[model samples]
Target: MKIKEYRTQFINALTPIYDAGEAESFFYLILEEKKQLKRIDLALHPDLAFSEEEIAVWNSILEQLQQEIPIQYLLGKTSFYGLDFEVNENVLIPRPETEELVDWIIKDTATPRNNQGLKILDIGTGSGCIAISLAKNISNAQVFAIDVSEKALATAKKNAQINAVNVTFINQNILETEDLQQQFDIIVSNPPYVRNLEKEEIKKNVLDNEPHLALFVEDNNALIFYKKIAELAQKNLVPNGQLYFEINQYLGKEMVELLEKMNFATIELRKDIYGNDRMTRGSVQ
Candidate 1:
């Protein structure tokens, strides 16, 4: 069958569940991954064909997409911060807001800090996206990442290697640790900040497929991870060390207050591309 014809069927099958634009995007993503054909290739050729075997594979993926499985997981990989990562049920797929958070850190660390080597840690580093991205971008950074789930850590370790960055992966629950045991120039996390009440706000694809351990918190204590990590930062951050978080959009004011009460100096809350309060930074005094 002609690829373009199959593309129409594919988009139509998904348009009932996803919007036309999103369905079209999914079609092209699959096209690129499966056939090594870009949208331009299809447009120019207009005669590319899909073998029966290829259509069989695509039909399987389409069935899963109809079931609301995230395309990233269906593809078993995703691109984040210009690097590719393997994602599965074990980890939350990296989001654009998290990309903004990473950009902020990269730009903030552009200048040399007194010619000193930098140590950085990422807590709850599910896919090691933030840690590996930073280590890949920053030449002098020694990066370490921590996560509680062994499966998640395994994926993160593979991502670090895939990205060719030396990020030390640790298997530990940050909530249970007393001390970080070492100082770092920067610490970052995108820990579970989604309140139980916010579940309805999550899309079906994410809520049903992504790891809840990386996404939710109790409503009454939505800042549980932030508060705990902030306390650890107070002890583990070097003098003037910086801390960064990708936070829930609705809890920016509370996040600032938490950092303020913890005596984190120079606290700043920033919005993502969508202008939602999505990231916060604080420096140790």
Candidate 2:
């Protein structure tokens, strides 16, 4: 069948599960990934057809999308911070807000002074997005990342290589440690800050398909990872070292308060493009 003709069928199949915009986006995403055809190409060649086998594969992906599987996972890859990252069930897909957090870091550190071998660590570096982005951008940064899941670390390591960034990946649970055993000029984490109670706020695609261990915390101790990582930063950060986090939007005040009590200097809470308090930065005096 002609590719343009299939567009209507594709959107109709998914519109019940996803909104028209989202369904349309998914149709294009699949078209690009599966058929190597861009929207303009399909538009120009309106009669360009999909082979029976290609149609079958697209139908399979449509079924998974209806089941709420993430398109990034369906493609087995995603773009983050202008680099490609492979993702799977083991890792949380990197979000745009996290890109903003990385941008904040890159802006502050992309200078001649910071090119002198700055040490950076990314805690719970699920897809190694933050660390790899920093390493890729800053050029002279010594990037290290830790994750509790060995499977996730493996994927992150592959991503680091794919992005051609030199990041040291470690398999260790940050919560179980007392000392980072090294000092860093910067420490960043986009750790699990979503409380179980906030599951209702999540889209069905995220709640059902994304890795929960990377997304959620106990409702009673919503700040557990933040608290632990902050304490570690207090001890492990060099004097005047900076710390950054992509935080849960609902806990902005509490996050600033926690950092203040921890004696972090010049704490800053910044909103994402969505105007939610999505990032925080603090520094050791």
Q: Write the per-residue lDDT of candidate 1 for residues 112-201, one digit (tens) a residue.
A: 773257899999999999999999988878999999999999999999889888998899999999999999999999999999998889
- Runs in model 1 deviating more than 4 A are none
Residue-by-residue lDDT tens digits, candidate 2, 1-285:
888778889999988888999999989888888778888998898889989998899899989988999999999999998899999999999999999999999999868897679999999999898889999998678999999999899999999899888899989999999999999999999999999899999999898888898999998999999999999999999999999998999999999999999999999999999999999999998
Worst 10 residues of 2 by lDDT: 109-118
Model 1 shows how many backbone clashes?
A: 0
lDDT of each: 0.93, 0.92
In candidate 1, position 107 carries an lDDT of: 92
Q: How accurate is candidate 1 locally (lDDT)?
A: 0.93
**lDDT for 132 (candidate 2):** 92
Pairs of colliding residues, candidate 1: none
TM-score of each candidate structure, all chains considered together? 0.98, 0.98
Task: List candidate 2 stretches off by more than 4 Å.
Answer: none
Clashes of 2: 0
